[model samples]
Target: MESVITGLILLLVLLVFISEIYKIRFERKNESQDERGQFLIFKVKSLSYTILSAGIFIGFALVAILKVMKPEIFIYYMIIVYLFQSVASSIYLSIVRKI
Candidate 1:
């Protein structure tokens, strides 16, 4: 039962993630006429990607060095990286858009 519940939760989360991706893609396709906004979005995305990539690489190295082979650990690390990237991007966009 626990495993079933967990699977359902994971499914819901995946659906939500997919929906968010879809929404973002749709929104980007109809970008605003404001070039500055678009530029800021591009910058935020680039910065977030860089941070996420570096974090994942470091995580992989640490896991390898520590001999940690648990899939759950890697999943948790990825979740943290993703959350951090999202928050960082939002903060950067907010600050830059204010300028």
Candidate 2:
């Protein structure tokens, strides 16, 4: 049951990311009219990609840590690790924007 729920959640996140990227790409068609907005969007999308890449890196780190430690609640620990990665990415982006 938990695995099924996790699968569904991941699917939903994938769909959301795809739809958002598609929507941004479609909006790029009228570039001349909205250069500023387009630039901002591009920066945001780039930052999002960075965030995703960082998350993947963190996930690999988590797997290594789990393999070494072999915790009893491995799945739960992985989920928590992923969540931390997401939060770290968000924080990093937010800080970058501020600077």
Candidate 3:
């Protein structure tokens, strides 16, 4: 029962998160950019690249220290990390561009 309740709560949160993302994308669909927007885009891209490189390095270090030789787990971890960083970078750029 507890597990079921937890799953339900997690599902609810996921739904809410997805809805919010959809709303943001919908709102920005027609938005146009200028020179400032171009600069912001460049900065965000650079920052994201740096973060991704650092994250990959840290992930490698973690796997080495833990002696996790499973290629599947390492691949999954890298995918998750990349997705997380991408989402975070997108959200940050959206907010900063709006402001």
Candidate 4:
């Protein structure tokens, strides 16, 4: 089970890397140099901010309601959220361009 999780994570990482490379190429062509590209960047950041804010809300709720012990788990939770946001936005941007 752990191996499967590891494999999936590795696959996701590889996909994100490829997507970033494509994003770079696309940008180099000046495809995203205009308002549309700026809009896409705005959209990606908006989505990322939404995710980040949700994470913050959840963290606060968990702390207030559950009174979480140690308080260190929040660090891990935040790391996961930010990492997910990065990858998810990257993928979203790439997919939007293709569409």
The candidate scoring highest on TM-score is 4
TM-score (all chains, Cα) for each model: 0.62, 0.43, 0.60, 0.70
Task: State each model's C-alpha RMSD to the native.
Answer: 5.2, 7.0, 5.0, 2.9
Candidate closer to the true structure by TM-score (higher is better), 2 or 4: 4
Clashes per candidate, residues 3 or more apart or on different chains = 0, 0, 0, 0
**Model 3 scores what on Cα lDDT?**
0.66
TM-score of 2: 0.43
Rank order (by TM-score, best first): 4, 1, 3, 2
What lDDT is obtained when candidate 4 is compared to the true structure? 0.76
Please write out the lDDT profile of model 3 over residues 1-99, one tens digit for every residue.
999967865665565476457435634554425667567667667767887898788778777876655645788667656655655666667687689
lDDT of each residue in 69-90, candidate 2, tens digit only: 4445556555554544444444
**What ranges in model 4 sit over 4 Å off?**
1-26, 68-70
TM-score of 4: 0.70
Error of 2 at 37 (Å): 2.2
Better of 1 and 3 by lDDT: 1
Task: Predict model 1's lDDT versus the native.
Answer: 0.70
